[model samples]
Target: MFGLKDLIGLIISCFIILPVVTFIRETGYFIISGLLGAKNPRLTIGSGPRFFKFKFIDIRRYYHVYSWFSFDFIKAKSKFAYISIYAGPILINAAVALVINALLANDFFEDSKTFWNRFIFYVFYFVLFDAIPMKTVNGKPNNGMIIYELLRYGKRIDYNEDPIIPGTTEAEEEYQKEVEKMKEIKWKEVEEEETFYTDKKG
Candidate 1:
């Protein structure tokens, strides 16, 4: 689906995109980690030389603090927080896009196009991909849900929580019990198909 138009837009966007996203990511990590306190965090992106360096945070398991909350609450908070966190990156992108569109359309800032582009590029040099994945990864797969599973079922992982990832023997047994219990409750399906009468009716 990529064509000349897409390629052109990509090239143009690249002029404002690469550094903007990178910077936003790195700056975000630094700001969050700083707020949380202890060791400063640095994030890196792409396959090239490391731009931001990740350091071991000295804080004592602060990231796991959110586990105290319920699964529903955690999920809701994460989603809401993500939007707030990404606001800066979106704004930066919008601003750069507007500037580039204006320059390309009216040729008003022809002389400083290079200057604006360079400024945008350099400003984002500090931002990196690792910074952005902080909330996205939640440090581990189960994250806040793990605590809820433990509290509710007395196990770190619920039976159906992961259909693919196998649980311990006890959890498996518990899951089978849950399944059998659920099976006892009969559910009537909507009888739209009458298999026995269909052929005779025809």
Candidate 2:
């Protein structure tokens, strides 16, 4: 039966654990792409308007929901390189979860064992979904599907024009446009509210 403890756990999982795991997952891509000489790489966390950007990391307002790593171009453009890039998140998450599990088995972090266990569970959960070949809700192929297609057909077979990893430059441009649009909408709302007050005063 669901109770207060369950509710608290759910809140922590959604707001804290999941976001940290997501950042780690994206870090896998950032690390692999950097090693392969991806130019101007950027890691954007969450969607919607930007909150703050420092160095190559952009944190959005909704920081706990979605994240992605992008680059302008890769110096090593090869099938093997692409495969390594896609496999990065899966391998990294699995490695982290395994290491934690081993530590737990050795009587480490016993005081915070519950938190660590939950963290490991979410890590493996990400690995399981990411390592399976399937199409995502947006009709884009997941990393596993991309890797499988690459291995089997020697290329991506998706009809989607958008690249799996978007270019950082293009993404930034799109983000700026979205911000401007949002600003315009906010101004319109303010103007409407002001007009309503002015008419009431008359």
Candidate 3:
């Protein structure tokens, strides 16, 4: 399906269509997350350190295609919360695609009809592809899988709560023990310093 023309169109569309898609999708996350009362909703358009940011809009935008948003789940544990936060982008992108398609059907931009149609196709394709229920190459769950899990389980599934390695509780216990040992040593040093100063004063 991807001929030379299609490949060139995809490359061009990345520059033209991707940023707008990212902006709308990520902004939807922020708006929906806030409306659902998620604490500290943040919208960042790319991973790693932010290359640019909007303090007023609270969006950190980067030059890459990857983007992310997060919030405290304290108040957003409900099914609707999951829908609002996770499905917001998918829904918004769908809406945008529909609007573009409507405009295309009407031949709204006669001079730029080809470009508009291509844009519409790209947007729709992105929405459908992203809505698939699968983990991405980066191992992050897509919106479809997220929503499906929330519906099935009645809450968000936290992968982080799972063990880093299967059947290896001993590693966790050892890590905890090391932390406690460090804390005890620090406390002992503090106590010794306090005793030395008190004795000198006396």
Candidate 4:
């Protein structure tokens, strides 16, 4: 059995990923060169099954199709009409899991809505996942860019947290090198952060 900490971490990550899955399922489209002439196009599913699938069309192309579909599933070319289709599942699925956990514990999160819960979950999820890169911009895993972009674009990174661009800043470069060192040494979070800040701050 996993410990409470592990369970909590899982839920947080799930919430973030679930919405992205939903967004992709709904709005995003993939094209496959392997679409067999024999198979029924009528029965398309996730990752579209084809004898040989090819790269999905660009996000822009999918965007056009989704727009016409009226924000539904990929039912119409224009259905599932949003770019953040994957985002829905990432958010909702995690929420559902957390909700179930809360209900079993007789904690409703006050009708499944609490700002503090949301914030903490986001923080946990961001810390874990921001370490791991997400694939955007043509399914390319943008590694260090994740945390950088969140800080840069979303302004989630605190002013107190160093504002170094991931690769450009010497401090950030050192930070990343330290992260790699921890990974190499398999240092746990407490040890990693402690050492990282100690060296960087000192």
Candidate 5:
């Protein structure tokens, strides 16, 4: 039966645990790609308008909903390099889950065992989805699919012109443009509302 405890757990999972796991997953990309000499890398968290940015990390308003890592270019552009980059998130999450599981088995963090268990669960959940070779709902291939294609054909099979990792500069420019458009729309709405009130008053 659903109760207050379940509700609290759900809130923690959605807000805190999930966001941390997501940040870790995206960090896998940053770490692997950085090692391979990726230039101008940026890790963007969430979607919609920007909230704030710190160094390489960009936090959006609706944080915890979505996140991605982007780089302008990679020095080592080989099939093997691409495979490693794609496999990064899967391996990283799996490693974290295993470590947590082991710690739990040894009776570590007994006081917050439930929290740690939930954390491990979400970590493995991320690993499972990332390690599976399939296209997402938007038709874009996931990391597993990309790795599989590279292993089998030694090349990306998808004819999509867009690169797997977008350029940091390009992404920022596009985001700024989106913000401007949003501001313009809001201004228009405010003007219309004011005009409507004036007419009604007169």
Candidate 6:
């Protein structure tokens, strides 16, 4: 038999808790990547086909709770891409945990490990789980594994062939923009290197 608190917790977890936490994580990725100059970085929430979708700035939010973050391969420099991808779950989880702790200290939540407490703990668990490299059930790499691979080999584990959201042509446009941005970045680097060499010579 579920008590009032339990029932309320269940409802909030289903409708609010999961969705809000997931949004914060995904949006963190989007914001960090964009600030790092990623071009058309596509941020997604949930795994399945999108039921509700919209674009904000350079982000596309898929309205569901179960979520992950991804970006165009060519969108960012390798280091920036790695940080942006890795920052989502880790940064948000830490920030949320701190806030939750403060709230609990203020008696916002009960001292016992209730639903709210457990929710906060679960968020922290997710951060650790993702930050530790491991493979998923289907043998695909998790975020930590991807970050490790990227740092070591300059490549990431290719989890899927089609990295596109269903029923959307955004990937195509994003790819084109990614290519153009990469080209620009490449030329800029080359020009900067030449200038540096010229200045050294003179």
Winning candidate number (TM-score):
2
Q: List pairs with backbone clashes in candidate 3.
A: none
User: Could you give me the TM-score of model 3 versus the true structure?
Assistant: 0.64
- Encode model 1's per-residue lDDT on 1-202: one tens digit a residue: 9999777656655645544444444344344333433132323233222223234212122122111100111122343343333343334444555566667568767776765555455443322322232222423423234433434655533334442122234433554576566555423222334544676698
Candidate 5 ranges with C-alpha deviation above 4 Å? none
lDDT of 6 by residue, 55-96 (tens): 632332344476655554444566656655575667877788
lDDT per model vs. reference: 0.39, 0.93, 0.65, 0.37, 0.91, 0.65
Could you give candidate 2's per-residue lDDT for residues 139-202 as a string of tens digits?
Answer: 8999999999999999999877789899999999998898899999999999999999999999
Q: Pairing residues by index, what is the TM-score of model 4?
A: 0.22
Better of 3 and 4 by TM-score: 3
- Where does candidate 1 stray beyond 4 Å? 1-6, 14-19, 48-202
Candidate 5's TM-score: 0.95
What does candidate 4's lDDT look like per residue over 1-202, in tens digits? 7999777756754554443433333221222101111111121222311233233221221211121001112333211221122233234435544554566467555664443455445534533442444554444333234335454564332333432111113422453586588576765777889999999989
Order of the predicted models by TM-score, top scorer first: 2, 5, 3, 6, 1, 4
C-alpha displacement of 111 in model 2, angstroms? 1.2
* Best prediction by lDDT: 2
Candidate 2 whole-model C-alpha lDDT, 0 to 1: 0.93
User: Candidate 4 at residue 38, lDDT?
Assistant: 14
Question: Please, what are the lDDT tens digits per residue for candidate 5 over residues 1-202?
Answer: 9999999999999999999999899899999999999999999999888899998889899977489999988999899889999999998999999998999999999999999999999999899899899887667788998999899999888776677778999999999899899999999999999999999999
* Candidate that beats the other on TM-score, 2 or 3, i.e. the better one: 2
> In angstroms, how far off is 144's CA in candidate 3?
0.6
* Candidate 2 vs 4: which has more TM-score: 2
Better of 3 and 4 by lDDT: 3
